[model samples]
Target: MKPLLFMILLILFLPWTLRAGDATLVSGTVKSITGHPFPKADVHICDSEDGRPDVSAQVDGKGNFTISTAFRGRAYIVITAPHHRPVGHAIFLYGQPTLAVDAVLETYLSGTHVDSIQIIGDFNRFEFDNGILMTPDQNGLYSASIPSPKKRTRYQIVIYESKGAGPRSDEVRSINGIQYDELEYDSAGDYRSVINTTAPTTTVSFDVSKLPIAQGTGYLKLMDARERDLVATMMSIEKTIYNFQNAFIAAGTGYEEHAKLHDSLNTLLDADVEAYAKQTDDFQRELMTLRMLSYVELSGSLDQQQVGKAIGFATSIPPSSIAWSAYPTALGTLLKASGGNADTRAYLERVATQNMAVDVRPAALYFLVGHAADHHDTLRQVTFFRQLVENHPYNHFTTSARLSYVPRTEIVVGKSLPAFTFPDFEQPKQSITGSSLKGKFVLIDLWATWCGPCVEERDSLLKLYRQFEGPQFQIVSISLDSDPQAVRNFRKNGPEMPWQHVHLPGVWKSPPAELFEVATLPKIIVVNPEGKIIGVTNGLKGAGVDRIVARAMGQ
Candidate 1:
């Protein structure tokens, strides 16, 4: 009986023991683009690049390194080296004891005089000094091995020399075959290198030229070659018109040039859309018409007659058609284009009451609420929000609608200013806090490096500061930039703003911004000598700012 009981216990606990001790072994070799073995490369193995690594290793003379960790499933492998572009890859390590990843490092520098190189990105928060440095070899190539970033992560590289650091470089892909656009460090810049570690959705890439004709044509097996040819020709014309419109907008072409291009494109698009609308009763006709109308609306060059025609065309589409899903968006555009007239408002109200498709109703309600809020119709806004919540309780828009009802604290006269502390951009040790500015009237300028209007407002602010130059008045400018280096570089090269500048690197979500409830750029908040909030406005020049300051100074 004792032997049988022991056997049963071993059988029950054996599975648990195996699971508790499940360790994965990951090993890899590093190589240069020329197939030479890469040595002394820093290797990091982590669940994500943004997060701390579970294990770190350096490649040996033979360009090989290994790490053993309890982490299972998917893993990221990030490698870095001097003079070589940093690259990363994602791999799965489940149901196996070991996984191997061999990767190539690309050379980023072509000329000499570069003493060192480092990478700065979301992984390092874009700090100039706080980055992973690469090790150089006799061949002038650098290498390092570090854990990889999580799947779908983005990052940028920064090259440094004896004078100072160069601007951040573009993101490098793992394959090294194709080149992506350079990463932008500006506030509104949308360039970042992405690491995709999953299987692609489609085996073949979509062809842009064929996209217009192929979309809805998949179901028309009975159509003749002649009919299909006509559809293809119309699609080709639509594509040409769209391409010209996009080019003109991107180039910032003059109004005269723009108007000429717009007329030519609009004529072609209108003719094609009218011909197709008469021929087809299918969803394709509705989709094509909506696309043409959206282009005109986005161009911002539409006349009154054009706007009226787009509205009528949008309303003609049936609610049950798949193409009807985009009608709400088109309607919203027309409503805005018509300058929110009575007719447009009535049409929007009618659409809001109709039993529209699930995918389109939330957008229609959101536009209605926005229009009401823009006009300061608080009651109408609240009613729409309530209707949206009651009708679509589980929709994604419901949460946003509920949050909209939460009243934000407005920074105005007679309220104690919110307290905050931030590192001075020039001197990190000496902090600029709310408590430090007690005896002086402070004009707190919250700005970002990427905001054009914010930079433009600096000159006026400087003039104001010089006008009231004394011990009692001070201007403290706080920068909400993500990278400290970007702020530093801008100060070195950009226009001079002579004032007490503090660098708080969180962009829009920085601590001071959160404390002051700043939602727009060039936000100026004036605090009195006793730390009482006196006034708040989007611009510093106009809107009774001078009056508020003069009163505070007892002028």
Candidate 2:
């Protein structure tokens, strides 16, 4: 289930309209499928199927709601109580005497077929416990009911049995009639419990460890909780897709089974996520998959026609959707590949104009800046930046306005490298300008000490640098470290590589940082001898970076 905080934040921007008429009195109580009354549940009435609000209320302590408002047409009513599954039903709102309806919520459970399973998942928004307990019925079936709870939820069931009877309170639990280490429920743990959507059986597996555990002995500890149902199963699979997508892009190989599962899970996830459209996690996963698919073409592994098809698929995504952080990242890649074509630019422009709940405007602005810079369209960048700065004057992103849109005159790519100066490691002033290296290919690696991915790729950069080292090929490294001591430490203790290196002082506010739109670390930019920009790539680690360097250097 989406976090309440996240959902509230998303709803902050929902459009609302006021309507008046002869009032119709509607009252109802929210109940779970198991016949439990829901308390403090939100009740909403919308005039349209798209959920345009007409009137809303919250269930009282007695799980009852009363909405007296004027209406002319039919409206849809929705019930969402905390910690329970959400319920939706239609209401006929007219100048009538009264309207009454009963809303029922489904019982939330992690999975089926566990002797004693601990529940964990997104339902409690990853909280270890939301107090959703399952008890076996007379028919030998485990069941629990939650009243009209929040809209979306993802939950997991961990079954625990007793191996030996020492005391009622023991940490280690049993599985399959055997006892082993209790399931470690760490809030920060990397494992996300996945349930089998295809079957009633609750399947538990961790991403960090592929080992499958079942319910049995002592007391089972469950980790990872969300709203219970098929939604949780779909979220788990979406996460799997994202993981595999990243793995494939990094390794330049495909995982067929994972991909198939990803597609299969996406069908259910799409409907579930859209039904509860206020969350960004699902959007994040989808955008990531789209970006990964784009990489299959951007890496030159696929032809331009293939790239076009991918872009078409990307454009097919709904327009109102925003990906928070991933939105800009995806936009950047698409712009680079499609050169801001009509369809692609339309999407970019829409994102730029939309009211983003997250701080994704900066990324959108940066993509536009990059596009304007690449095309030398100063007017576009200037207009966009000015609008951004003016509209969001107090926004944190405004600080980078100057660097976001640089003067075209100062940025020359094809001629001898522009005259630019950066501070040396010893503060002795080291510089690289057009006059110094007029006829050599230079690869600039914009990195920082604090970035783990940057550090991991250091060896690959070194190897790529060494491979192309000659009169025509050179490598320059720039560090965006706030503390000079940190850069010095990295220089002394980090990967040992012989290359011209300099630190630009501030961490992210450095001049070059905003100028180059270095949102994340480890940015690689290829420049010809004359300083003509060739290619720019980021998030390249290990062999991924190696391949980029090799292809760039014609090796």
Candidate 3:
């Protein structure tokens, strides 16, 4: 839907105010995974039919709540408890004066299913090998007694499962799973045990009957048929994806498995979301679009195929103004850094070059530029970088970075290095001006004591300086550490970096940092003897640094 139309429909969903006496009252008990009362849960009575104003209430410490809505008994309810997964979506309570809803939510560990349950947590220093296997009693019920830890412990349930010639998952549980859309919508907090429990705390039980989605009983009954079926499909998707991940992790490699799971997740975006979009008004679609941005990011490490699918999915979203504002920046990062395939590159090129997709163009322009840089396709890198700068001169993505702060064209090979200067770290009298380093190939090393990569590269940089520092070659290491003392301390305690040193010490805000537009480190800028730009790189280190500097020096 067009954003304008979406906004227009929102007016229809606005609530019609009524007196407090005529309000619909919703009362509920918030139950933890253990079937005990949970305090401080939030219940929201929403106009599910339309996106009207929601009446919300926070449960008291006793885990009971009563909330009144202006709507006359037609509403949808959502429940959230602190540090716990939320329950209720498509749980529309219609034409009821006063209603009672007892909600049951599970810990993060509850999602992982297994034939046998064992707990691994901070109590065991998160050691999977020494996990405490729960004892099964009857009807698939399991129980485990843990010696209470001094502080709250986070954990996950694992079972004995194995795949040959892979990490011994049975011996030490795997921390991998498929992230279904439902869980993505619901906040996934760290699985934490009850805080500061005293002695006589009852054994935490996993009664299969009481479990919500696990047993397909508790909360499913509350959801109407349509919602129940939708959720069931979502759950099934999660299980299939979960099994795929387990197999992938256990066997340690499964390209096809990864691709299939990736496609299944995307189906949630396409089939499920599209079907729902048709059912709801444009206002809800707008909200869904916003959520779609958040939803796309739910997965952990992506395979190349997965990355391609992700790009395709995000690119397909219609560019609404509000959605585009922050989306492009993230989208740009994704484009520039990840995915390698014909579809990925093809989609990116279209987005970048297509003037109509202004919001998306910034990112599409970004992907190919970085792809060129990664393969050392210097010509394409320069071409794409120039396009990125020219096409996005008045870029919209920078207006608010969800509220970040993009690209180096000025310092690319064949361009003249912009004039800049910085004061010496040890001596205020001495300055390392761009003009002073003339008639020599200069390596402007933008680094910091705090940057791990920068610190790690000190030895290699020192070697580079020693090998090439001559009348025709000079190396200037600029320190962007916030404090000059950190550099001094690092120099004193760590590897000897005996090159020409200049401290441009406001970090990124430092004068030379602005001149270079250095966003990441360790940044290496190589310039030839005549002072025209030689090359620029973000993480060109180890053997690559020597090669980069040597090529610039014509040796």
Candidate 4:
């Protein structure tokens, strides 16, 4: 009964299926050039690159094939036959019902067929030798195609000369200050070949003869005074980076050349950022900022004054703009530039706690608490930690915050060392507690691998270990890393913290972080044999570390 109803429905809608807006059906003919022997071609079809379903078929004796699949929207069709070049076509099947793609397989070559020809770009990870091979079929356009899930992608072409010829010894040529060298065909300053998949066109072309190759400086000169415009400056920067990348290929990728190019790129980036500031069109400014602001602001060369200007621009972002639609990473940049200080704290409090237009407080406060301990401001650290935990506990920023606040509020120099027990790093079952070493002068060091200050203080820790690692003087380094394996991994290659190493996961929210009232990492609590807290990280970091340890030992 179901089959009979389906047959009736097909009879009723057969005309519509053959016409427009029906299920996607691709029919094609794979014709081999006359007199060129080739096996039956394999027809490969896929909807998208990201693990989407794919369908395959084979060409019949007459070189005719049809593919019926559930794929809609963008579809990639590839045809490959033995001893012949492969061909791929990109098509949009959203509004179309049935499509016709004819592929002609050719075992022939055109113009001086070099050692190899390949397409390299974001699609192929830009690996020259391993790029997608382009084969000309019956002297058709030399091209390769991949279904782009992205709206568009940029690519360059590479051609290798025969091995006997070796590499070119001299610069091929220079046009408008752009040099295209490295003998083997390098698409250096070529107008970037971008395939915008937004169009429903089936085949994307890369005809080198028609490309505007090596015309960057020439394009800028034509722009003339308009080069000062933000978009124009960004274009200029893009061309400059492209030229630099080609130079890397020409010069053999070296760190020295990379550093020099980075300096040059940074200059152009500064200009682009300056242009962003002066952009008069609000929408264009937002667009430009969205594109290049993150690059410029995080370049680490932006002066405090420049950061001030950027902060103002970020604040001015209209709520409706897509730039403001997502969490403002621009705010995070400003907060990092300011670092943890009175001004940064005030900003977070006003912006987030006060419910200002752009709420940066929740994120900013978490970072402040982490950095506050670096400067040895326990008061400021605790104050903001409490505020973040109490106020924005469920905000995405605070969700990973400390699980619970430490009960012991203050960690003074004269107070009794806070009691605690943690498993040894290597022997997890063996407990290392405050009571384990009753007669020795102990140093309870709280730290994690992710802490920059703790990493810097490693040499100091090693020096103290060497100078006074004895029975009378003991140091137990406790880690607050969330991953126990991370501590083991760090110790594997990093400076070995061999003396009584202990692991206590959850750096910011652990019992150890709370017991010592850790403001920041590399926090060392010095205690006498009597278990009285003698000193903190303050005297145990610089030149004072050895002095305090020797004093603790009473030597």
Candidate 5:
């Protein structure tokens, strides 16, 4: 009986002992490129999601620190120091009792005067003000440590100067030694930088100088070659189509020439798709697919037979192909060009019902639902949105469909302008309110400095402003920049619109934007003398702006 009791007790305690031993001790040393230790550098061990530090410690004057935690899965270590770029690394703690990491810090030198630096990222929801400050050393290097309660793989370091130094500017720079998407911009117009701590390190390096190309022409040369090749092929097709169209117009016939040109283009597109399908790289295949779709759109109108052929071509690509996402847009364009025939509808229905990839099915369904919405078929729109939400409850499309059901504050024509108060970009203390612009025909331009389209539209906006620069008309240019300095920079260096500019630093989530449901930028809302919204459009192309201003001024 004594032996049996002992055996049971041992079994019960063994599991507890094993669990207790799973706790990990993570230690690291941070040094600068100059071989100097980062004294009192901020070291954070964070949870993978929330970015809250679980265990934190400071590097001593010798640049050494240690943290012990019960975390048994993946986590992140973030190191920040003054004058040095913030460093983050993803680490896994399973099957290890202790782990040591040695990091070499790089300095932040963007040829700008920076009074302070802080680290911010997705782990903390990218809140600019909720940044972790770094302490600067005598040598101009800074360091700090915080306990990381979550794990994250990406972050950005913001360098800020003093507030009164010509608009309180801040510069966000990418972390070195990491590859990130060049086109990933946040709502605030800040570029996103990614760090892959999960990937294995490779030490292979190659010299590009040995290649038969000029120093700066490596990527440019490749881009030029691609552009030339595409343009040559497109021009050849364009010449044939041009001649065919001219002949058809002159003779009031020649359908055979049109058919031949269409067939030839289709054949070329098919061959390109087949070649792209053979590529091992998914991104390359997707690029080729996009090129082919562009070719189709530019070729000409598609008849019933050609529409069927295009749909067949799209469906021929396997659901597993990465190029599948491109098909929805291609199919939607073809359907629109084909005037939405029953055959096209059936093809879309087949895609939606098929056992396709998770992404493909919802995309097909979304196109159909979007088509219904475009036609103002409210009943069909609601029904399809409901179906999407019910069938794919966890899909991203379902979330969008759910939001579509929510009642939004309509800023439509004949409605009163939503009341808002924002500070002037040049003078933050002075407020600009909706009531102040009463009795004036206001062109309320909601825009951001970093938006390329918005910047391009500046020329058109200035032309309108100059055309109607009187007491009856005013251009209230509202900037959606998070950093006030960005607006100031644009005002000083970019186009001088000479209009009443307002700056409210919330970007897309600003009060005015949220109230008006301003999802896309360069949104222009024209208000009459009665302070009622008269015209709202996402674009201000051609003489449309002049006509709107003229109508508003009662010209």
Candidate 6:
């Protein structure tokens, strides 16, 4: 099962999903790209990304599935079928019950006999089309064109071969930021073989002379020897980069430990891994570039002059001057106004032009584009977006990047919200719709009774509501709680503030959750009198929310 990554996104953006609304009904259908009816698929309705399903239903023999749900603010629907990857979309159901969404399901493969395998990471998520099979060349060498993402992303690849067995055992070997466990087969039964790479907390320069290659291995061992040390160093560097990134985003204690690990990795750049650096694979060169980038970031936590010294050291080594896939973006963010822009651009462009994989090019462009956009170069931004669309129109992320530059008014925002009608908990006779607030400043708050932060923010929300509760403003609270009883009890016992409240029988896929990208709870959206969004507050303090409400009300 995929890690509950959605849960994390929900927590991060909760302030936008929890909102209360009037009674309304929302209905939708599911279909394929080819207009074929989809059946027996599970449908979900939730308030935010973390919204739980209030109502779940399946299509009949025909491809149509419609269920009633409330539209407090924004909602989303996720659909899944056996042997098919789940797909979801966002919809705004202010109160219109007749909303329709036709979804397409992507096919997923199962079972063994797997051919070429591809991976997705910081560069991109893995897709079926991206995989390539390993083929043995005439020279008795197995080779495959495994591309890496343009971003300084890390990934690991594992190869499983079934041979001589009651079942196919794995001959797992990890590479390119990928990880795997070695599978050994003998009469005794399947067991792990050697632990080839030790987990290093910090990226360390491997001393090639100290490494030993045993004399009694097979042909695979011989080929591995040609690249093993370099591969090991690259993997270690990649791990270090991940550690730094995690530390950068993680909250609370042990931060110093992470910082020390970052510094320790930088120390390896000067330790002389020249033997691996001279290898034919691009692995070592890439590792050096990554090390230099990390060194640059590490310098910032120290003295300011230390950064200059680190850059001077980076400039001394030709390969170290470049940025690895994801490093350019990090470095750009870190060194924006510093004079490192020129060097960073040069390094990024060089990587774009290298024998690097197909996905690697766009990341360089994105970093450069980000820098240019930061400087308000609309032409450059347009050009980059256009390039992305033209070159990678079919790529999943291309459209998202294209949409980023577009003002909300021009695309999915400003338009009248969708209509929704669902039953109230008491009588099952509640209906909600966006049209009810045709000319009011609708304060949409997406929350769940279970979310501690959300519960804490409710008081401030109530205060804000009371302050703005005249003809010009209204508050809509949409609960993402999966249980209906919880929503009713919480509203009754938690806070005495008077406001519109609606609970979608569906949990996370509620029509409102999808509309607003309510990945997090406790989200607050300020809708103008024209039903257009004025601003969105992800985690604003109650005081901050009050200020926004006052400004919206012209107080």
Pairwise TM-score winner, candidates 2 and 3:
2
- Cα lDDT tens digits, model 2, 283-360, are 444444454443432243334554565566556555434332322345666766776876777777776666242244
- Candidate 2 vs candidate 6, lDDT winner: 2
TM-score of 2: 0.38
Q: Compared with the true structure, what per-residue lDDT tens digits does model 3 show for residues 288-340?
A: 44333333443333344534444554555444322332234345444443445
Q: Tell me how many clashing residue pairs each candidate has.
A: 19, 39, 1, 1, 24, 89
Worst 10 residues of 3 by lDDT: 178-187
Q: What is the lDDT of residue 409 in candidate 1?
A: 69
Better candidate number, 1 or 5, judged by TM-score: 5
- Against the true structure, candidate 6 has what lDDT? 0.48
Cα deviation in Å at residue 31, candidate 2? 22
Q: Candidate 3 — what's its lDDT? A: 0.53
* lDDT values, one for every candidate: 0.54, 0.50, 0.53, 0.52, 0.55, 0.48
Off by over 4 Å in 6: 1-289, 292-304, 307-343, 346-350, 353-356, 392-400, 406-531, 536-555
Error of 2 at 411 (Å): 8.1
Kindly report which residue pairs in candidate 4 clash with one another: 189-214
* Poorly placed runs, candidate 3 (over 4 Å): 1-339, 342-369, 372-412
Candidate 4 lDDT over residue span 414-467, tens digit each:
888767788877888898888887788887778776554465466567778778
Tens digits of per-residue lDDT for model 5, 1-555 = 012222222221111100122466767677765455553366766542224455667677887778776653334556655445455544444434667767666654423345666665555665666766766666665543333333324455555543345322233443211233222322121234454343332111112111121111101011123223333433444454455333333332234654565566677666765686577864455445545654465454434454344455554544434244323345555455546666666676676665233344565666667667657878877776776666666655555444434344677788998787877766778887889889899998888865544664666688788888989889988888778787776676566668888776577677767766665567788998788999876544536767887887887
Q: Which structure among the candidates has the greatest lDDT?
A: 5
TM-score (C-alpha) between model 1 and the true structure: 0.40
| Weakest 10 consecutive residues of candidate 2 by summed lDDT | 218-227
Best by TM-score: 5
Alpha carbon deviation, residue 496, candidate 5 (Å): 3.9
> Which regions in candidate 4 have their CA more than 4 angstroms from the true location?
1-346, 353-359, 365-393, 396-412, 427-431, 504-522, 536-555
